[model samples]
Target: MSLPRQLLLGAAALSLAGFAQADIAIEMHAVDKSGVGKTIGKVVASQSRYGVVFTPMLKGLSPGLHGFHVHTNPSCEPAEKEGKVVPALGAGGHYDPESAGRHGFPWGDGHLGDLPALFVNDGGTADSPVLAPRLKLPDLEGRALMIHAGGDNYSDNPKPLGGGGSRVACGVVKSAPK
Candidate 1:
């Protein structure tokens, strides 16, 4: 092979190889009072040397703003919440294992699990990649992806938890099949 041809082939090979290393898939499912069952969409998380990119294609959602965050647990069943029952209560609070207990902007070093609010269109579909610079793809493992019933102000003033309301949908983060 010619030197120039060989160089071009080598470059192409390296570029394709780079994609293989970034195949981290995280899937989300719909969870009501039943449980974490129906898969609504999947987030393909690609982590570069500097950060992770979460590309999501979510569907079958209500038309409105939903509070999206990473919770500490993997279960999506309804559980006890201050002596009352709630949807996806088993997922626990936002993945604030660090115990920060604050909210407002994912870039503001707020709650560790804080993420950009998810906006669903009137047709009940959302296709946007929400960014979370504070987290890596691997950090989602064993955790849960939650979609709240209401919107998030990213602040705690009139209500707690940004008034996101109850957990409406959830998905457990796990490694893709080999």
Candidate 2:
């Protein structure tokens, strides 16, 4: 085989391999008061050295600010207060990749998982372009994302998003099948 032809074939194989590895899907679910689980959205999370890029399919949501976070626990089971499963808070706290000092959105001092607010449209849908740092596919095995009733200020003061009042919805993240 010619040297140029061999090089071309090698590049083609590498491109295909990269494409196959780049695609990753994570299962997401929303838990409600009846202890019933609903499919709220699916986050196609891609891993990079920087963090995880999540592209969510948003629909059937109320228009307004929604608090989105990575909780510590992975349990979708109903919380004691209500039958609903609070995955965000339920998971525990924010995803602190660096364990750095506390800070707000657009800032990197706080938890690596701390993301910007999720804005919904009147049509009851939201599309998020957010990143969760220090997050690998393995870390999300049992973790889930919770949507709050109110918006997240990303601060602890006035008691808006920081308060974490209600668990509007939640979705458990599972590895996509191969």
Candidate 3:
């Protein structure tokens, strides 16, 4: 084969490999005391040079900043809290395998699940893509993706868990079969 032709084929193969390696779509939904509700949309997680990039294609959210994170459990069912059912409490706390026990920036030494705050437009849609520089595609496997009712200040001082309030929407991250 010609040298130029071989180089082009190699580049194309690399691009295809990248696509094959990046595939993890979590179907998000509205959650409440009852249970998981209507499907909001989906969030596609893919690999990037920096880290994992979560591209959200969500709607029907309160127009404002919503706290987003990866929770420890793989379930999004409501869990009982203080004798009352809580939304998405089954997802447990943020994915903190390292036991950081704190909420901070995506790149901070706190909870590895601490992600960037999601912004929903005035129309109640969230299409922005947030990058978790400290995460990889594998790190998100068998976890829960949560959208909080409020914003995340990336701190635990003024409020716990960045004062994200209740869990509004959630989705489980299931890995594609090999």
Candidate 4:
């Protein structure tokens, strides 16, 4: 084969190999409640350069904004029988990849789990986008993504993420199909 032709072929092969090596698969699941917790909806997420993009499958949700965050632990335990949460702020706190030392989205120094507000429709269904830095496709392999009751202001005024209330729903992330 000619030298020029061989070089071109090698370059093409290398390009294809690089494209094939890109990480693009992400998995999502609907976390089922164990006890007092309310099973609200499901979430489907995928990884992107910005972060982990999320698409929530909401049902029976109340109209208006809801607080969403990436909890530290991967457990989706239900609220206690006394109507109190198992861990005061179980699900751990916000997912902090860089540990920027703050809460709320757009802060740039906020937790990776501090996502944008989730607005539900009149029909009680919410379909929105969220980004979590703590999740890098690899870290999300066994972690959990949770949705809270109230709306998030993305600030710590009345509270971070609008002091979004209780843990309404939860989901565990998995590796996407090959």
- State the lDDT of candidate 2 residue by residue for 1-178, as single tens digits: 9532443343334333443234455455655555536677665655545455555577777898777776656655555535534433445656555665453552346665555566677888775445554456566665666667777777766773365566666666665333
In model 3, residue pairs whose N, Cα or C atoms come closer than 3 Å (at least 3 residues apart or on different chains), thus clashing, are none
Q: What's model 1's lDDT at 46?
A: 61
Best by TM-score: 3
TM-score of the candidate numbered 3? 0.86
Which 10 consecutive residues of model 4 have the lowest summed lDDT?
A: 19-28
lDDT of 4 at 107: 29
Sorting all predicted structures by TM-score, with the top scorer first, yields 3, 1, 2, 4
lDDT of 3 by residue, 57-145 (tens): 99999999888999999999998989999999999999999999899988779999998888899999998667777888888888999
Considering only N, C-alpha and C atoms within 3 Å, which residue pairs clash in candidate 1?
104-154
Q: Which stretches of candidate 4 lie over 4 Å from their true place?
A: 1-40, 79-90, 131-135, 175-178
TM-score winner between candidates 3 and 4: 3
- For candidate 1, write residues 49-97 as lDDT tens digits: 4344455678888999889888888777887657777778888888886
Q: How good is model 4 by TM-score? A: 0.66
Question: Which portions of model 1 show Cα errors greater than 4 Å?
Answer: 1-22, 176-178
The residue pairs in collision within model 2 are 29-171, 71-91, 72-91, 72-92, 73-91
Candidates 2 and 3 compared: the better one by lDDT is: 3
Question: Any idea what lDDT model 1 has?
Answer: 0.72
Number of the top-ranking candidate, with lDDT as the measure: 3
lDDT (CA) for every model shown? 0.72, 0.58, 0.84, 0.58
Better of 1 and 2 by lDDT: 1
